[model samples]
Structure formats: structure tokens, C-alpha cells
Target: MTEDTLRSVNPATGELLAEWPIDDEASVTATVERARVVASFWRELGFDGRKQALLRWASYLVRNTDELTELIHKENGKPAEDAYLELMLVLEHIDWAAKNAKRALAPKRVSPGPFMANHEAVVEHPPLGVVGVIGPWNYPIYTPTGSVAYALAAGNTVVFKPSEYTTSIGVWYARSFALANPQLPGGILTAVTGFGATGAALVTSGVDKIAFTGSTPTGKRIMAAAAETLTPVLLECGGKDAAIVAHDADVSAAADAIAWAAMANSGQTCVGTERVYVDETVYDRFLAELKSKLDNLKPGSGADASYGPMTMPKQIDLVREHIADALERGGRALVGGLESVGDRFIGPVVLIDTPEDSRAVTEETFGPTLTVRKVKSVDEAVELTNASEFGLASTVFSKSHGMEIGRRLRVGATSINAPLSFGAISALPFGGTGASGIGRIHGEEGLREFTRTHSFARQRFAIPGMALLSFGRKASTVAVIRRVIGLKHGRHS
Candidate 1:
């Protein structure tokens, strides 16, 4: 790989910000090999060594929070405040993984069956050699670090291929790892820069495991590619998450959550609530409150702005098309229309009277657009919410039955009287089911996800029955054996 070959363009301004090298196949392979060797040494360091090293990395992130946030903002086109939030979340994961990896991944004893009582059984978690991570452009640091930090804590070396759109932040992350521990090999925490081809190379580069975060289609492609190498994968794909506002819900609080969930980061979040199901009894009132809140949101790339431009310019057209399709199909835009989209940032959009089957409700717009639908009961709300092929995160607001409704919704995690709150807690497992993808990455599962379980059985001594089996066997011996076995294991009391 050569330096200063690829340029990083700011999506908000279309300006050339920075340039980086394009890592080729040879370099990627070499990096993977280096990771394999380093992983061996890292595994030997055990939980305490890895934990201390990760804590040092967390400290670095905390000490240089502003600089890291700035790089994230410049590379991903998010507001500085949101970038800071991302860094904070990443640090939380780093802290949690360091503290919990030992208990979560350590070997544990298991009971052997009576037939094998002379043997001792234990299961140990071993590192999966090298792990390849293909991260998304949105929430660059927080999203990938959920996997990267956990993988490291589990004793696996990582080769992270951040989205080409946010390669600078990726470089910054890898540089931080090097600065924290120079003894660590290059592949222990490596960064590879390129387009989709580079990501594809990482998935197929004979890695022990691959953790990917992106669209469903891209996830399917990555899974297919990994299948060729029989490598396990953890995919965090797209989600058309829904927010339900019951009649008993707190109107103001629900409105605030919906506004933040839909418009934050210009609604480029995978788990952002795109569709809203409001009880018909309070539909008008909820819509009014939501509209009032949306009206105050200002979209721009300035330091003080509430939201930033869409990180990927091409998504703007898709947002437009979805809105246009909904309008053509008898849907009405209550707050914003075609004029809401600008050269870079898109103003907040709230739509109502949209058909259930409209593209606006069914597909992932990935923009600052919220589609509100009226339902008669919570059953109807859950039906509409689960109608989509994507099932990631969801939110339900009901003072009386928030937990009930949340449990019924088909999503990985649900927030009651809140939005994206479940993800904020590093103790919970985060990932979706169905088309949203499989597997999890957080909490104890997160650490174990990057490791392979190894079972160890040690034979203590041979049983008398087994030793006498080849010596001699008689009818009386068989009767005695049966009686002993029956007395030991077959009694009802």
C-alpha cells in the first residue's frame, strides 16, 4: 500500500479533506498473517494483560476526546456533538469489555455423566485468530468499536476496514492503538482503506470471523463471500424501526423521542425510528406535538446545528423518491415535502395519511422523514410495526402498558418512553433478528461472539467395570452391574 493515494471528500461540502493509501490484496493478506501471529501472543497474555491494554486505549480516547470527535465529524459529516456522543459510547464499550471479558470468556467446569465420571470436563473460550470488521459510515467509531473492542478483549487481533467514506477516522483509531502499545504487531489493530473491493477482500481473507455493519443487501453479499471460507459472521444491517404512541402515552415525551429518533444525524441511523404508529384516539394530538417539535429542528453542518447533512449524497435521491412515491399513492406530507431537501442537508420531514403499504412506511428511507399511521389498538400497532421485512430496534410509549407493547414488538431491543436508550447501555446485547440480520454484539455475548469455545476433558482413572470388560465377563457379573447401575441412576425417588 502507498500513502496519500485516496482522498476523503466531505459529504456536507464536497471538499477534499484528507487522502490515504489504498491497501491492496497483498497488503491485506500480509496484515491478516501478522494478526494471526500477534493473536497468538495476545492470547497468551490472558485476560488481565488484555484488559489493562484496553483500559489504556480507553484512557487515550478520553484524554483526546475532542481531537477524536473532530476527526469523526470531518470524516462522517455528523454534527460535532453527535460525534462526541459516538466517542463516549465507544469508550463505554471499551470500559465494559475490559471489566467483563474475564468472567465472560473464562473456562468453566461442567459435570461429567455417570458413565464418564472418571473424566473432568471444562469449556474454555479461545480467540478466533484474526477478525475482519467492515464498518459503516454512520457512527463510525461507536458502531465498529462495539465489535473491535470486544474482539480485542476476547484475545483476537482485528483488521478493520472502515467505510471508505470515513477512512480518516479509521486511520485515527488504528493510530491510537499503535500509540497505546507499540509492542503490539501491525495486524493486531490494522486499518485498510479502499472501496467495497477492499471490504470484500477482508471478508474473504481467511479471517476466523467477520463482523459487518451495513445494508441488508450488502450483508447478504458479505455472508455469501464468508461462506466460501467457512468463516462465522455477525451482521448488523438496516432497520425500518417503528415507534408506537398509545393513547395513554405521555404526549410531550413521546414527541421529543420521535423527533430525536427521526431527525438525529439526518436520520441516517440504522436503528432510527422511521415509522410511527399512533393510537387513533390520540393520533391528531400526537401528530400536533410531533410537528411542533420537528418545526424547531434546524439541519446544517455548523457547530451549533441540531443535525448535519446526509453522510452519503446518493441517499438524498432515495429519500426523495420514497416521499414522491408516498404522495403519488395518496399520502400527505404534514410538515415537509419535495422542497425540504437541499444541496446537502435535508430539513425535517413528517408525513401522515400514508397508506400502510406505501414505500415510505415499508422501506428504509434513511433520511429525516417520519411516517405516522393511526391504529385502533396496540395489536394493530404491533401488526403494522412487524409488517416490514426489517426488524431492528423499536420504541413504545404508553404509561399503562409500555412493557407489554414493547415485548410484543418484533425487534432486537425496545425502549419504553424513550428511543435508542437500550443501545446506550453497554450491558445489553445489541443486534437485530430476521432480515435485520443475525447474531449479537454487546455485554457478555459481545465478548464471546469473537471467540471460539474449546472443550477440554481430562481422564482421571479407568473405571473398574471398563478394566474388567476385556478380562472376563459372566452372567453373575452382568447381573451385579445392572443392579448397581439401576440403584445409582434409575430410581424414581
Candidate 2:
């Protein structure tokens, strides 16, 4: 394939799936400009029209779920079942956005401040014209749809750039969306394929906003490029999400949750559990149960496999490097170790007593490997978890105080008594706080993320005593405003 085209290879068999043309900077810019025209029409459709269109798209997705799942399997080397689950998640978001967008984005009356009682004020959310999405290979359908569904529901057109490792699946989505509405080809939703250059082109392509899901370093690069155009970018980046097991927690349940979180999708998820901190009182029990569960899980690109292969081949090396470093630093493997990381599938590698400073604990392994640490108390566990620079989402496995502990953790979303379950709840917002992400998706917050707030005020009648709003009214205007402010807010002081 030439530089203008990209080749999609199946990670499980190293077989080429297809060759697709890549969009250059000029083409990317043109795509965004075209989207702007369609965006105007889409926005004019109002919430009701957009909702109908999105529901049609969701229906198309549901009708073709089998084909889409197979495409994801071929392109990303994930199991067909997992791909189906991802599709289901995407459909849930689409349905939620369609049903909730009108209520979330509709203009609502708000009481004017105490000083302007005679004025009627309202707030309206207007579409952001066009949005550009840069999706990741792992969970490509679910991750990008988090942005695409919401943006469309809020009346914004989107230009999606799926990861080069999974370009065929991205093309499938674009085609299906077009099929949903034959009148709009590149207008409402479009897909661009390629590597990093194509994504960079999208970032600086004059879109109203860019929603990116990838590594923290790549997110920084996207932000920097978007800066050149003063474009707003919402980034869902890397994470070293931790699962904390309190002393009084259910050891078996926590172990099961941790095992699934760390090993699902071969541990390629951004919010997947990478670290586990258990109370020293029950750490041994938890570790034993976790190893027992993880040992039974298998990784392969088959129907019988518990999980699948690494979508990106290069991630295998990083997983190996982290395992080696952990072992070198006096860590013991409870399950699979360096030898488990193969060319395509990374078997479960469970490390125990790993040093805090080790690469396995510090860096995002992004593999089916997890490092378990023992802490004296839940307080210590929280401290250790918060010490990491990446705070995307966390899980607390305490029965009595799971919610309390979750609230104390500094992250975008927290799961109580479960592992990353917050992602499945369509009403909850999903995004990271620090390096995890910049903006949220999946709920009302997600719908608002693609739109801008416009405040409206119309004076029904004049307030005789409210003179501060008028220019050059009177010297008493300042006195009246100060007295009112003191009456309303000064009591607390």
C-alpha cells in the first residue's frame, strides 16, 4: 500500500483484511467544511428530527449487529462475543441520547438574580456545528460512539477517525450511518482511515471540537494541535485505574471483580483495573482467590476463549517490559509472568508485592496483567491509589462503605462493589479527571459536551430600585447594589 492508503491486518493471524485510502490534511479539512454545511441542516431539524435520525441509525446498528461484530473481530482481533457486547453498549448510548437529548438540551427558564426580578432569563444549548472523533482500536465501537451518538443527538455532525488497526470496522459504521439516511453521505457522519497523521489532520481540520480516545501522551499531542486552531478538544486518555479491597470487604467477590476487570479484553481497556490494593488483613486471601480465578481464564481469538488477543501488536512488548521490570524489582508472579506474553495473546500475568516505583505499577501496562499491593488500611489504600498521576476511574470493593470510599477517590467515575460498572450505566457520565480524560460522555453531561450554552434575558418590566444595570444611572445605584449584595450574601460572613 502507498502512503495515501493504509493496510488493516488482523492481529490474531497477521492477515491483511483490506487496503483503504487515507485522508490527507487537505481532505480532512474539506470533510470538516462539508460537515459544517450538513451540521446547519441537522441543527435546523431540531431535537425531534435529530432524535429520529439517531434512532434510525441505532436501528441500523441493531439490524446489522452480527456483521459489525464480525468486522470488529477481523480487524481488532477481539472475540465476537466481546464485539457484540461493545455493540450493545453503543446502542444503549444511542437510545439514551435519542430519548434524553430534547430534555437535556432544551431551553429552560431560570429565575433572574434577586437584583433583576422583573427580567425573564432562560438558557439554551446550541449545537457546536461539527465534531471530529479520534477513536481507539480497543473497544472502537463503544468508545467512539460515546462521542458520536451524543454529538449527533445534540444536533452536531461528526467526522470519525477510527484507529488504523481497526479501519474496516470504522468504515462499516460510516456506511451503515449513510444507509440510515441516504440524503447525507459525508454530511452528517463520515469516517477517515489512516495512522497518526490522519488523526493529526483531523485535529487541525477546523472542526468545532475534537473528541479523542487514546494514550495520555497522544491526548496531549491532540490538544496541542487543536490549540493551533483554537478548537476545543475532549480527550479520554490513559488510566492506571485501581481497585481497593477494604479489610471488611468480600474477598471472593473482590477477587472475581478484579480478575474480570484486569483480564477482560486481554486488559486493553483504558479504564481496566491495572492495580489492586488490598487491606493487609485480607490481602493474602484476596490474592489467593484472584489467582485461582485468573488461572482458569484463557486468551485467544475463539468462541471458547475468555478473552482475545492484543489489538495492537506493539502493546505486547510494553506488557513484557513491565513484567520484566516488576520481576527484576523483587516481585513474584502469582499466575502467568513474562513467559505468558506471547506474539498475539497476553495471558494473565498477576504480580504480587510489586514495588511502588516499578514500571509495572507506575506505568499503564495495558495488558492482561495486574499488580497487587498490600496496604495496612483502607486509608492507606486510598492514599496509595491517589498517588498515581493517572486518575480515570476506580473501584472500591467494600460492602458497608463502598460508596463512601468511592466518593473519596479522586477520579471521574467510581464503581461501588463492582469493576468499571459505571461504564454500563447509560445515565452516568464517563470521563477521567487528570490524565484519564478532559470531558465526560454517556449521559446528560455527554449531551451538553457537544453543545454550547447560550443565555437569554428579556426585560418584562423595569425595576425602579434596580439602577445598577443601567449605565450612568445615579450615584445611589452603586449604594443600592452594595446594600442588596450585603443583604443577600453578607450574612454568612
lDDT of 1 by residue, 1-493 (tens): 2453778888878888888778778878888888888888888988999999899888888889889888777778888889988888888999999999999988899998866688899999998889999899888888998899999999999999988888898889978987887776566798888888888888888899999999999999999988887889999999999999999999989999999999998999999989999999988899889988988788877877888888888899999999998999998999989899887889998888889888888888999999998999999999989888998999999999999888897889999998899888998999998889988998998888998889998989876555434656567667877888999989976
The stretch of ten residues in a row with the least summed lDDT in candidate 2 is 463-472
The parts of candidate 2 lying over 4 Å away from their true place are 183-186, 463-467, 475-493
Superposed by TM-score, candidate 1 places the C-alpha of residue 337 at a distance from the truth, in angstroms, of 1.2
Each model's lDDT = 0.88, 0.90
Pairs that clash in candidate 1: none
What TM value does model 1 have? Answer: 0.95
* lDDT measured at residue 417 in model 2 versus the true structure, 0 to 100: 86
Q: What does the lDDT come to for candidate 2?
A: 0.90
lDDT of 2 by residue, 1-493 (tens): 8868899888989898999998889888888888987788888888888888888999999898888999888888778988898998999999999999999889999999776788899999999989999999999889999999999999999999999988999989877888987765457998988889999999888889999999999999999988987999899999999999998899999999999999998899999999999999998899889988987799887789899888888899999999999999999999988889888888899998899999998899999999999999889999999989898999998879888888888999898887788899999999998878799988999999999999999899876756665685877887777887898889994
Best by lDDT: 2
* Reference-based TM-score of each model: 0.95, 0.97
